[model samples]
Target: MSGGVDSAVAAARAVDAGHEVVGVHLALSRMPGTLRTGSRGCCTIEDSTDAQRAANIIGIPYYVWDFSERFKLDVVDDFIAEYSAGRTPNPCMRCNEKIKFAALLEKAIDLGFDAVCTGHYATIVTDDQGNRELHRASAWAKDQSYVLGVLTAEQLAHSMFPLGETPSKALVRAEAAERGFSVASKPDSHDICFIPDGDTKGWLGERVGIADGAIIDREGNTVGAHEGAHAYTVGQRRGLNLGVPAPDGRPRFVLEVRPKTNEVVVGPKEALAIAEIAGSRYTWAGLPQQHPEESFDCEVQIRAHADPVPAVARIQPTENGDEFVVTPEIALNGVAPGQTAVIYVGTRVLGQFTIDRTVSAVPVGV
Candidate 1:
C-alpha cells in the first residue's frame, strides 16, 4: 500500500464493492531516518506501520511481505549494471515487472486472494473480441500507462487499478480525508523509489567503482578527464567541464557515451539528435497475434513524461526473437539506451520495448 492516500482509497472502494480485500505492504529492508515521505518510500518501516493503520481504519487485515533480496537482485543490481554500460535504466518499470506483477501478484493468488490491486492511474478494457487492452485514464495528466506497459495478459486478468477512473488527484485526497487516512496531503516522491536521494551517480560509483576515463571532443582529442564514463549519458547538456572553449563559441552537449573505451564524447547541439531506436527485451500486454513488425504504425514513448509520438516501427530479426526499430516522424533529442520504449495506438497500447541500441539515420542536408 506504500502508506499513500491513493492506495488506501483503492482498498476502501474495493471493500465497498463487496470484493474480499486484504492489504499487503511489501517490506523492503532499510533503516529509519533513511527513507523519505510519500508513496515510493515503501522500503522504510514507518510506511509499513502507516499501511497497517490504513488497513485497520478500513476494518481489514494486513501483513508485511518481505521481498528485499529479490528487489536488490532484480531492481538495484540491474540499475547499476545498465548505467555502467552507458545506459539509463528505469528501475520502477523493472520493479513492477519483477516484483509487483510477477512476484506479488502470484503471492496474492497463492494466499487465496482473487486479485491484487494498486493505485495506478490506468485502465484495462476488453473489446468486443474479449482481448484485454490497456487504455489511458480519464486523468490524462496523472496517467501512468508508460510505466505499466510491461504487464502481461495473465497479470491484468488478476489485477485492478482503482484510481483509473478517478479523474482528479484532488478527488482522491478528498476521499482520503472523508475516510480519515493520514497521508492524504503528503507530497509525491519524484525520485526513483529505491534511490530517494536521487544520487544515481554516487550509487553507481559505490557499487561498480570508477573506470578511469577521458572527455573527448568529436574529433577524438582528449579535452578533459571525467570522474567516470558511466557518470554521464548521451545528450547530457550539463556537467561537462571541458577545458577548451568551442571554436564557434556555442555550448556543447554530450553526443555519446562509449563505455568500451571509457570515453565521454561532447559536441555541438546539432549532434545530439537520433532517428532510429532498436529495443530489445519486449513484453507486450495486449499485442495481437500478428508480428510487431506487422503492427507498423503506432506511437512510441521513449521514457516516462515523454509525449507519445507517431512512428513507423518494425521488428528486426534477432537471435532470441526480434528487436524493435522505430523511426519517429521527427528526430528525437537525447534518446538514451536501457530505457523502455512503449508503443501505443492512441488510447490502446501496442506493447513495450527495452532499447538495446539507437542510431541517427537521417541523411544530412535533407
Candidate 2:
C-alpha cells in the first residue's frame, strides 16, 4: 500500500467488491529508517505501521515482503550503471518492470493470488474478443500509465488498478478520510525513495568518484574543467561552471555528456533539439495485428509528465528482439539515452523502449 491514501482507499474498494484481497507492502530497503515526515521517508517503519493499520480496518491479511536485495540489484544498480554510462534513466519504470510486476506478481501468483492490485491511476480494459488493453487514467493530472508502460501483455493480464477511474487526488484523499484511514492527508512522495534528499548528482558523485575532465565547447575548445561527466546530464545549464561565453552572447547548455573520454560538451540551447530517436529493449502491453510493419503513426512520450507528441515510428526486427525509431513532427529538447520512450495511440498504451540514441536536428559547422 506504500502507506498512502490512494493505496488505502484501493484496499477498501477491493474489500468492498467482495474479492479476497491481501494487502502486501513491499519492503524495498534493508535499512528503512524513520528519517523524515509523512510520504518523504516512504517504506520506513512509520509508513509500514500506517499500512498495517489500514489493512486491519479493511479486515484483510497484511504482510511486508522484503524485496530489498532484488530491488537493489535490479533498480539501484541499474540506475548507477546507466548514469555512469552517461545516460539518464527513469528508475521508477525499472522498479515497475523488474520488482513490482515481475518479482512481486510472480510470487503473488505462486501464493494462489489471481492478481496484484496497485493504486496506480491507469485502467485495464477487455475488448469483445477478451483481449486486454492498457489505457490512460481518467485523471489526466495524476495519470501514471507512462511508468507502467514497460509492462508486457502477460504482466498486464494479472494486474489491477482500483483508482483508475478516480478523477483527482483530492477525491482519493476524501475517500480515505471517509473510510477513516490514518494516512488520509499524507503528503505524496516527490523525491526518489533511495535518495530522499533529491540530490541525484551529489549521490552519484559519492558512488562513482569524481574523474577530473575538461568541459569543452561544441568546437572542441576547452572552456572549463569538471569533476566528472556522470555528474551532468544533457540539456543542463545551471552548474556548468564555464567562465567562457558564446560568441553570440547566448547562454550555453549541455549538448552531451561523453563518458568514454569524460568530457562535457556545451553549446547553444538550440543544439539540443533532436527530431529522431532510436531505442532498444522493447516491451508491449498489446500489439495491434497490423503493426510490426516498417513504419506507422503514433504518439511518443519522452518523459513521464511531458505531453505525447505526434510522430512517425519505424519498427525493425533484431536478433535480440525488436528495435524502433521515432521521428517527431516537431523537434524535442533534452531527449537523453537510457530514458524511456512510450508509444501510444490515442489514450491506449502500445509499448515502450529505452532510448539508445538520438539524431539531432542542428547541423554541424552551423
Candidate 2 lDDT over 1-366, as tens digits, reads 888888899889988888899998889887774123456656777788999999999999999999999989999899999999999989889999999999999999999999989889999988898888999999889999999999988898899899999899999998888888989998886667888567788889998889899999978999888998998998898988886777888888888889999999998888899989987777787755265556888899989899999998877766876678889999988888998999898889988989998988997567
Clashing pairs in 2: none
Candidate 1 per-residue C-alpha lDDT over 136-193 given as tens digits, one digit per residue, 9 for 90 to 100: 8888899898889999888878878889999899999999988988877866655776
Q: Candidate 1: where is the Cα deviation over 4 Å? A: 30-40, 289-291, 319-321, 361-366
Over 4 Å off, model 2: 34-37, 317-321
Model 1 quality (TM-score): 0.94
Worst 10 residues of 1 by lDDT: 29-38
Query: TM-score for every candidate vs. truth?
Result: 0.94, 0.96
Q: CA shift at 152, candidate 2, in angstroms?
A: 0.6
lDDT of each: 0.81, 0.87
